[model samples]
Target: MSLFCHRIEVKSVQTAGIIIEYNPMHDGHLYLLEQVRAQLGADTAFVGVMSGNFVQRGDFALLRKHARARAAVESGVDLVLELPLPWAVASAERFARGGVEILSATGVVTHLAFGSECGDAAALERLAEALHCEAFPALLRRELERGDSFPAARQRALAQLTSPKDAALLSDPNNILGVEYCKALLQKKSAIRPLTVRRAGTPYHGTDLVGAQPSATLLRTLLRSGERDRALALMPPVVRRVYEAEEAAGRAPVFRENAERAMLARLRSMTEADFARLDEGREGLYRRLYETSRSACSIEALLDETKTRRYARTRLSRMVLWAYLGLEPAAFPRQVPYLRVLAANGRGRELLGRMRKCAGLPILTKPADVRELPPVAGELFRQEVRATDLYTLAYPDLFAAAGGTEWREGPVILP
Candidate 1:
């Protein structure tokens, strides 16, 4: 019954890792955590590898990572690990790969769980296998040549090579990422088994709050619209409390538009060659950015000017973020170099003790440790620092906008 390369010993307690952004922890996230915990038994250790200040959607977190991680720990997760900025703001393939790699490095984790629309592990694995088939690459290239976006082309190729049902899974955001998680597990030859819980309530992009478990999108909409009470109602009490505390401290509710001026300034300063080196920058897209930045006065304007059928808004947004951060395509490492602890509870501290013995990579716990990393890792950490500095500028309070928080702040420890 084991899907992993190594069989779990009967006497050992199981540990499961979840990959999440928790951009703002809501009831839906709590549901997934509770469901997975129930399935694995109360004794199972729950670990989460979460995105940092930036998230996969090419936006800053509604709240900082420390606040979000604290909420996750209070809700049910024992430990939270930081997924570095490069991968945090990457495409789905790289995002899932980075998350799975970090979870696998922990060694004690035997299973990887995610929320998916289909929640069928077997079907997801089949789709993952199809992606690796020898024919997939040629078909994908054909779709790309036809001017389809990468996601659109990949879905079309999967539909043609496999079935419409399998391809349709990609339409559901969670299912698409779930498939990538399985693919990463296989690619890494990881010993962790993959699992999925059914996503409740609306689709990932649904904007209206409708049930006990609402989409994060809907929650964000409510919060941004000044419907704080309504948004709080859709989250656990502890999560709500953390969100309130962070807001009181002037560090919550950061939006992409907060950095509108800085973003425009950075783009205006960059040349076509500079944009060409950003992730997803290619085929003269850099030239488009260069031309557009001259007249585009707002982030919305820049996006409208540069976006095309070939370049999705999310992809363009990620590219813009990379350009703003001065990150080149070669900046990221081929593989993740370290496991960083962002937040942990008492149980999490115990798990860290275990990781020290079995972790394949270094487990970083302090800002000073950045000095000890190899050249590549040090550069990656510097990118994170720079990103954090820029992120603080988005804080509602000017005093909170002062940089260097990355060095001053420590992991959130929940009692």
Candidate 2:
């Protein structure tokens, strides 16, 4: 059968995989979960989630990772697994690969469902096919020579082969992330099929969603505004209740400029070799970093100074994240060594039981549970600590109340 036919056939699966980062569990996420559960019956869908010190958006999880996971379980997620630092922040390709790989690794997920404007699963598959075309390599090389970053180079190259306006296809963060999901599923060649859910609410980052709810961006914006009650208004009752409890316990969420600055300062101190070591280091990227580091006062500022058509802001941000963690692309763990249980309720717990018997990876339930970390695992954990330290620094009051920890090896799970 054609690749299109194969993907279409996957809609009839039992369990589905959702790759998400619910910065603050909001109504939009609830809507997505409802759709997933409706599409595939209960207990059948598996949710492989990412929760760490930082999010893909290059910020702290509004609520802690464990809290976010619990929210997922409360919402109806069956399983929630942690996304490692490399996959968590590397790039769209790595994130998708990591997410798909984790869900696929569980050995229970049969369908990979996600929100997208592209609508048609077959079209995304076609896009995926085009992305891997034999001619793309040469075309990409030409674009790169024109001083475009890898992402920009690929987009421009694809546009040349396809439509002139097609460069916009991979521009949005959502679409870029979507394409990566398709690419990851294809690269792994796993039985778990890929599906894209037509977005029903607002755009990925759109702030307004009148009757129903606002996007996570909107919610974060409100929460960051110090209007905790108003910010809590954007989420579901369960989420608001949870946030309320955390708030009552003295955990008022705040954007951590200090955390970001600490990380940025570390980035500024790095030499060119350090930049090259943390992936995205090729051609003149090292040179760009060496030059940009001289005047960078913050992570966002450094990105603004160095960003160009050749080096997208997001790409630079990911590279900076890797640098903070000391994660070199050359040293990434070849295979997933373990699945850290971040959060799960009864259903999530049930899925975990199934994963135990079927999962190919070791499941980590405790923070100290690193008996068998693949090569980069230790360093990856260290990066997470750095991120948390940054997070704590940003919320000194919160951190101070919560022991103001340096880093703990074991499960720092909430609830």
Candidate 3:
């Protein structure tokens, strides 16, 4: 089996891999899917590794992962797999690495596709190369010592090492992640080729719905604010129906505020030593978190107290979320051990048949299949199970919240 081959053989299957959160599966996501299919050919299999209940923005997803996966397949994606909790809530580099690893392990993806503000694959690759140079770390450390945040310090370091033009690419969020994806591919020495599509319409952090394409951020705001019709209008018809069904079942529009008290209780109960273990930066952030948790009454208040010029609010949010979920940095795996299916269409089923022999990792279509894998895989699955149980506590209908749902539920298969 050629585990990470980038080259496409004559008249062979061509697969395109994408990393997505699809928090609500809006028009912008649909546009990317359409563009990739048009560029890669209609028959090219598109596999998306989606974030489960938690998203990279350091918050709960607007909807459940399986519901979003169903919307993804209905909208156009061939297959959807879980990105796993550790990677889903991690920093940009690890998030990109985990997504890339899952795609490469499939042994089928030829191109890793993503949307970028720069939309220039060569420029992103060059930026990735600049960050990997030996002298870059010293330069970055120098900038950090000046009390600049990580994002700012890294950009300055790149400007000094590369050209200002190359460093400016990091100004855009998509470009930053695109560069990380390329860096991950380079680090793994994998054969997967990086591909970028120019991101169009509203800015990534845009807060209001506008024009033909709106950011997921805007839609999420609308959903949480009870502007359901406006938010659903931005989504595909099938996706709208899916979200509607979830709403009817009292499972839609999950927010951090729903479980705010629980989160604060968990954080307040932790010791300074516990916070130290969960801190990834080793920048004495745990001390700030420990101090802040005592007086801070709400999650927002805790984040407000802990926020600093050097530490972004998003980073602090992840730390708080991990503490709430009992996730220690040590528990996060160095490598992804298996792929868990979320949803799939007929074409995805065909791809799975081929993956059985070629895949680099074990595939889990049913939760119980985890028993056949190594102990590490089982441990990860157990974490996922516990995560699902905790996630249910945030449901709009308390009666609908139930444990052991992860074990009884299987992947959503569409004929």
Report the backbone clash tally of model 2. Answer: 10
> Residues 209-313, candidate 3, lDDT per residue (tens digit)?
557888988888888788888888877898889988987898877889989988988988889999999888788999999998988888888888889988989
Residue 280 in candidate 1, Cα distance off native in Å: 3.9
Looking at model 1, residue 119 earns an lDDT score of 90
Q: How far is candidate 2 from the true structure (C-alpha RMSD, Å)?
A: 3.5
Cα lDDT of model 1 overall?
Answer: 0.86
lDDT, residue 110, candidate 1 = 86
List where candidate 1 sits over 4 angstroms from the true fold.
1-6, 9-12, 279-281
Lowest lDDT block of 10, candidate 2: 406-415
lDDT of 3 at 116: 94
Which portions of model 2 miss their true places by more than 4 Å?
Answer: 4-13, 148-153, 159-168, 208-211, 249-254, 372-386, 398-415
> In lDDT terms, how accurate is model 3?
0.88
Candidate 2, residues 141-248: lDDT per residue as tens digits?
Answer: 888788656777888887866565545667666667777788778778777777676666656777766657677887887776666677777688878877776666
What's the lDDT for residue 236 in model 3? 80
lDDT tens readout by residue for model 1, 120-226: 98778878878977999999999999887878999999998679988888888889999999989988888788889998886788887556678889888888888
